[model samples]
Target: MSDIKVISTENAPAAIGPYVQGKIVNGLLFASGQIPLVPATGAMVEGGIAEQARQALSNVKALVEAAGSDLSKVIKTTCFLKDINDFAAFNAVYAEFFNAPAPARSCVGGIDLPKGALCEIEVIAAV
Candidate 1:
């Protein structure tokens, strides 16, 4: 564990569970899944998947950058949706954050996300 370092930031919601926001090890940052809670108030963001995805990804960006990495350095991502039918809408919002050669991804739906959030996102990046 000597090579591991914890990462955190005030820009993202605090971890309400027994986990840190992220950890860097061997040049990689593993960020915990972020629900659509605003860091300032911890209130779940209101709206549908598109709105939720943006907030969740915003949290992810904060976590990733806390470890000195950016979205462009993300190598992979995993997204969870409360409803699978929201895939198209989720993708639309997601494309706004990631671009060409975007990180490898796996998205799933019907996830009973915490705080009843509409979306959640976790990432792995080169730190």
Candidate 2:
């Protein structure tokens, strides 16, 4: 088995559970799902779905970067929304974070997210 390195950073919200923020193994980084909690305050960002989506994506970016990778290096992502109806708004916000040839993505709705966040995002990237 390859050596695994745990990834964490103060620039991103601390993990609220037992899991670390992410892990790197064999040149790949796998980030945990990031909710809309503000890293500095540990408080859920307040606003609508778009605002919440932005914060969640921001948190994902921070964690990815902490693992020595950037958003452009992300290969895949999984997003969850409390309400599927907010998909369009969430997509618009998400588009701001990634460029052309964006990472393969899967967004699902009607799901319960941690800390009552409107959205959550996790990423896989090349380290």
Candidate 3:
């Protein structure tokens, strides 16, 4: 295998640690877990899971677009939440983006998240 190409975009939150926003390998785009952190100010979005999920997905949207793909091209997504009880609220927001024939997905509850954010998302998409 060749080196993994790092993917990044101003439209998405900048990598806060030692990770790239996403990577391309073997014609697939693998995105890092995107929290609701706003790239422009490096701050978490206001509100709870719904707003947080929205920002994170919107950020994912930007990353996919930057990689010459879009949400329709997404094949799978993994979601993380600080509280499982917020699942319903999160789904409400997520549904607006995925629409019908949604991509394969899985969500898990966690103890904590970066910047005290409520949710995070990562995606794999065709390229």
Candidate 4:
């Protein structure tokens, strides 16, 4: 495991479970799922899917940066939504983070997310 490293940051929510925020292995960062919880207070954010998506992606960005990567270095992402109808709104918010030639993504709706959040996101980035 000499090539493995754990990634953590105060800018992102602390993990309350057995998992860490992210892990780097052989030049790749694999971040854990991030909900809309505000890292400073550990409280879920307000508003609809858009707000939640932004917060969640913010958490993801923090972890990615902590691992010596950026959103632009992301290779893939997986998003979960509580309602499929919110996909459009979430996509709009997602675009604000990932630019042209955005990282490949796999977003699924109608899934239960942590903290009663409307959305959650996890990422795989180059570190």
Candidate 5:
């Protein structure tokens, strides 16, 4: 059987739906898509794309760390954006969290996100 473990952390926003924060299997951490909801308040953050992106990435970072990994160890990321025009702005914020040798990524636009968030981010990392 596959050895899969669920990853959870109070530092990040709890899952809004019926899902865990992340999963670890075979030394890899697969994190769920994180929106800009404040962990403590469970409220969507208010701001432009940059601010929202920062919060989303921060949530991702928290979950990654909770899984015994860090942003530097991320292998891939899938991002969802409500508006394509915010790509540049989102990238600017995303760059702040991920350093050089950044993980492979895919960002899609025009997707309706939960809680009307500007963006959401999910990642995979080495644990």
Candidate 6:
């Protein structure tokens, strides 16, 4: 087995605390949860759910690229949202990025998110 490689990128949000942005092992890249916080300032993007979802997914894309994989290679994903009602909006934006043979996904709604953000995303991709 190949040694695990931690992935990071300045284009994506820096992990708020003690954690790598993503890690690769055995031909798979596992990305940590991506919040809507902009990497340049480490602050949440100023917008609604759709915007937040866009930013979060963009961040996840960056991590995937940093891990030597691209969004098209993503096999699975987990999404967290502050409100279930916004699922359609989120899915709309999500569909723009991942279409056709969509990656397996699990999207859940919750009462809160870090920094009061509206969405967060994580992904797993085969390299």
lDDT of 5 at 108: 98
lDDT string for model 2 (1-127, tens) is 9999999999889999989999999999999999999999999998999989888898999898888889999999999999999989999999999999999999889988887888989889999
TM-score pick, better of 1 and 2: 2
What RMSD does each model have against the real structure?
A: 0.9, 0.7, 1.1, 0.9, 0.6, 1.0
lDDT of each: 0.92, 0.92, 0.91, 0.92, 0.94, 0.90
- On lDDT, who's better, 1 or 5? 5
Clashing residue pairs in all predictions, respectively, total: 0, 0, 0, 0, 0, 0
Candidate 3, residue 102: how far the Cα is off, in Å: 0.5
Report the C-alpha lDDT of model 3 over 1-127, residue by residue, as the tens digit. Answer: 7667788899999999998999988778999999999889989999878899999999999999888888888999999999999999999999999967999999999659888989989999998
Give the winner by lDDT: 2 or 3: 2
Better structure of 4 and 5 per lDDT? 5
Which portions of model 3 miss their true places by more than 4 Å? none
Residue 24 of candidate 1: its Cα lDDT? 92
Off by over 4 Å in 6: none
Write model 6 residue lDDT over 84-120, tens digit each, in one string. Answer: 9999999999997897799999999976878898888
lDDT agreement of model 3 with the native: 0.91
TM-score of each: 0.97, 0.98, 0.95, 0.97, 0.98, 0.96
lDDT of 2 at 111: 85
What lDDT is reached at residue 60 by model 2? Answer: 91
The model with the greater TM-score, 2 or 6, is 2
Superposed by TM-score, candidate 6 places the C-alpha of residue 18 at a distance from the truth, in angstroms, of 1.5
Candidate 4 at residue 34, lDDT? Answer: 96
Give residue 124's error in model 2 in angstroms. Answer: 0.4
